[model samples]
Target: MTATRLASVVLVLLTLCSTAVPDVARAETWEAVISATSPDGLGTATVHYQHLAAGDSPTAEEINDHIDAEANRAVTQAMWDGSTRRPWTFDASGRLTTWAITVSEVFTGVYNTAEPHMPMNRLGSVVCDTRSGIIISWDNLFSDKTAGLTRLGEQLETQVAAVASPTELRTWRRSGQFAPVDVNFKYWIPTREGVALQIPEVQFGRGLKVVIVPWSAISDLIAPEFLPITG
Candidate 1:
């Protein structure tokens, strides 16, 4: 072949090779489980968390590290801090659009037990974007924060009242947890069925109450990009 034709063919092959390779900057996650004990033999930390399985983007790496660190932090607080709490479950789910992480810890020891009669369980979670790794804020999830929060609050109250006793409902309403505010609804995780809103023991006189607000209920209120949140 002529030198010019040969060079052209070589350039074409190189372009195809590059195009066939996966993008290193694409963010992907892998879940890892570890059962570890503190060095001082005080307690144990068995946590399930996410890691940057495939991605080189700075944002993705940072978010992955943050997620890992947060999970480790929760376990560490229980172990080294003399809390004697055991993580019953540390579960997480991810899709092409979103990632959700949740941890449920049970208090076994007497330390920091305010209400001995009440349940000794705590729930926590973190949700973020899959690509940019930016933590999904309340503002990002809802298009109109005020209206969205009001709707969420209404749904939460309706769901809780359905199962809770009249007295329990009175206590829940007095607690002001279901108010249209971001701080009130902290423990929430995205699920395939809907967004699972958690009402911990502290907020409700009863034990933990999880209410799944179906996507259909607030489909229009949700941001367009976050529509059909898989998990």
Candidate 2:
């Protein structure tokens, strides 16, 4: 072995096979499922979600009994609930960068004794990045109080991220006609669970609206401890 010691033992066995390979076996994780199709599409329901940690916080009877058993098998009482939370950190190669989700909805309670219709509080926050689960940033806050009219809401919030893969666009304003609004979405990756967004068609000015959202339609009504950490 003398060609300069066999080229330094083949460069130390190629640096020990690139430091023993295995970065979580080339990482790409997903695990969560729930798919439902309706709005006059006959019927369909598939549920399988079990990934809740990151300081657990999913209650409201597990998102109102899975939205009252998928809205009473689509008969539709229209009751729903929400919650989801997880992912605080993991990036040094560990991946799974961020996640924070909060969703709430309480409908079917409307009274107008001249104008007293309330109840519909929504709060949603989503941040995802684990080698392309998509969703870079999203924030939504909606509150309503009647009897005199008081509705404060917020959404979209000028998001910017998503350089490629499927597609994701964001822009917002809309409150009281701030005007600007653009949210284009299309991203799907869930054989296991996490990342399935398709707006189909959503425009503001020209007014084309056809929205279809899955990923368990926002994680089976939220509150699965904010389920996030897909790396």
Candidate 3:
């Protein structure tokens, strides 16, 4: 073959080789389960959490570490803490506070996809402590907790107002619920799109209202621990 033709072929091969190779930054994640359980008023309180190891984005491990720590804490507290003092099934008065005590990890997207080195895979957990139940707010997941909460609260007002009916909005305002300035937003879950704020069942006699807040809306306020919550 002519030198010129051979040179062109070699260049094309090099380009193909480079394109086929995956970036080093993207780590392969092998899924692992970490669980802990403790006795509860009913049967038992269990925390079965998922951990992403050897996956993309060096920060995956750091985020999983946070998940593990928080999960373990919830189980431990439910087991030893005053959780049983007021049981969900029945309290000292023999009145049922709740049906059961169950805690589960609600991973974002409702599943764990740690591979491919994506941004922060935010985690939210719900520990059914019975009486009032246990919630791991988005604020608790970060360091600048107050600031994060403030932003989350403020954003929720707009989101909530857009969907609330006139009657519902009035009820919220008159009932001192969803305060505009104080955003006492509590109880959140990770959704496929963003963080979902669960309006307590006690508030409106139902939990049909869920204020879905995107991470971009409060990214600036999040702490370094769980910052850059982008996928």
Best by lDDT: 1
Tell me which residue pairs clash in candidate 2: 31-193, 32-193, 83-222, 83-223, 84-223, 84-226, 85-225, 85-226
* TM-score of each predicted structure versus truth: 0.62, 0.20, 0.43
Instruction: Write candidate 1's Cα lDDT for 1-231 as tens digits.
Output: 234322221100011111222332333445555444444344444554445443446655656555655554455444444333432222222222233332112111122323345325545566656556566657888999888888888888898788779998888788787889887777677666777786666676546767888877887898877774633
lDDT score, residue 89, model 2? 13
Clashes per candidate (backbone, < 3 Å): 0, 8, 1
15-132: candidate 3 lDDT, tens digit per residue = 1111221322222223333332224323133333343332343444444454455554443333443233333211110001111221223432111122332221222344222112
Badly placed stretches (over 4 Å) of model 3 are 1-42, 54-60, 80-151, 162-167, 174-176, 180-183, 186-205, 214-231
What C-alpha root-mean-square deviation, in Å, does candidate 2 show against the real structure?
23.0
**What ranking of all candidate models by TM-score puts the best one first?**
1, 3, 2
lDDT of 3: 0.41
lDDT, ranked from best to worst: 1, 3, 2
Model 3 TM: 0.43
